[model samples]
Target: MAGSVSPRFARWLAFAGWALVGAGYAFGVLSLMSIGVFVLAGSVVLTLLVRRAWGRGGIAGLVSGLGLPVLYVAYLNRGGPGWVCTTSGPAMSCTDAWNPWPWLAVGVAFVAGGIALQLRRPAAAG
Candidate 1:
């Protein structure tokens, strides 16, 4: 079975996928839910579509797929130049918007890693 993904990696991937799904729903971030679904579904689709030859490249493909939506959502929520305001009985305060740069950086890194993984050849089997 050349290029078959290991069972261990598959199990870990499944666990990560479910965790993402749970976290997304728990945190009320629907975009995360979407990404989780994509990961899970992509795994299955790749498994069937690529069969034995999917290998690490398939994992990389999923990582790439996972990144796109994250980038999109992060971009949308990147926040504008303004103060987030709050008030209480003759008192008022304001703060800057939640920064999306961290998320964007992470997304970019993951995307780059995925692409790099795909470009690199798999290690030789023992």
Candidate 2:
């Protein structure tokens, strides 16, 4: 065994998550924020499973799981991004999305840290 779960189980879990995410988007059963949450949670779970199969990398999952919430909270605090504006033949429209650069930087840091943890080896005792 590698860490906690088997590779076949992980693969099946991923397949199920993909189907669930597809259904959520296609059916509009989930709002934008809900979709985001679902995707992030899926990402964390899948990454942890893969890392576990990779052996002794499960600890890094904690850091990896932190990526989304940190960035999201930062975006919320920054009031998200200003609306996008477009004009055509005197018609105008606008839309918005969170585009916080600093938040992204922090989120990447957490993700990178998790990857680093997975790469590190535990010390051997004499």
Instruction: Write the residue-wise lDDT of candidate 2 on 1-126 in tens digits.
Output: 434766555443433343333333322322345566666566556555554543332445455445645555556546447776678998997667466777778767875776566446343200
Off by over 4 Å in 2: 2-57, 68-80, 86-93, 123-126
Error of model 2, residue 96, in angstroms: 3.8
Q: What is the C-alpha lDDT profile of model 1 across 1-126, one tens digit per residue?
A: 334767546544543443333333322344445565565555455445443443333345445555655666567556634556779999997767556777688678766776566446343311
Give the distance in Å from residue 58's predicted Cα in candidate 2 to where it truly belongs: 2.0
Q: In model 1, where is the ten-residue run with the lowest total lDDT? A: 18-27
Q: Kindly give the number of clashing pairs for every candidate.
A: 0, 0
- On the 0 to 100 scale, the lDDT of residue 111 in model 1 is 66
Give the TM-score comparing model 1 with the true structure, all chains together.
0.44
The numbered model that scores best in TM-score is 1
Predictions in order: lDDT = 0.51, 0.51
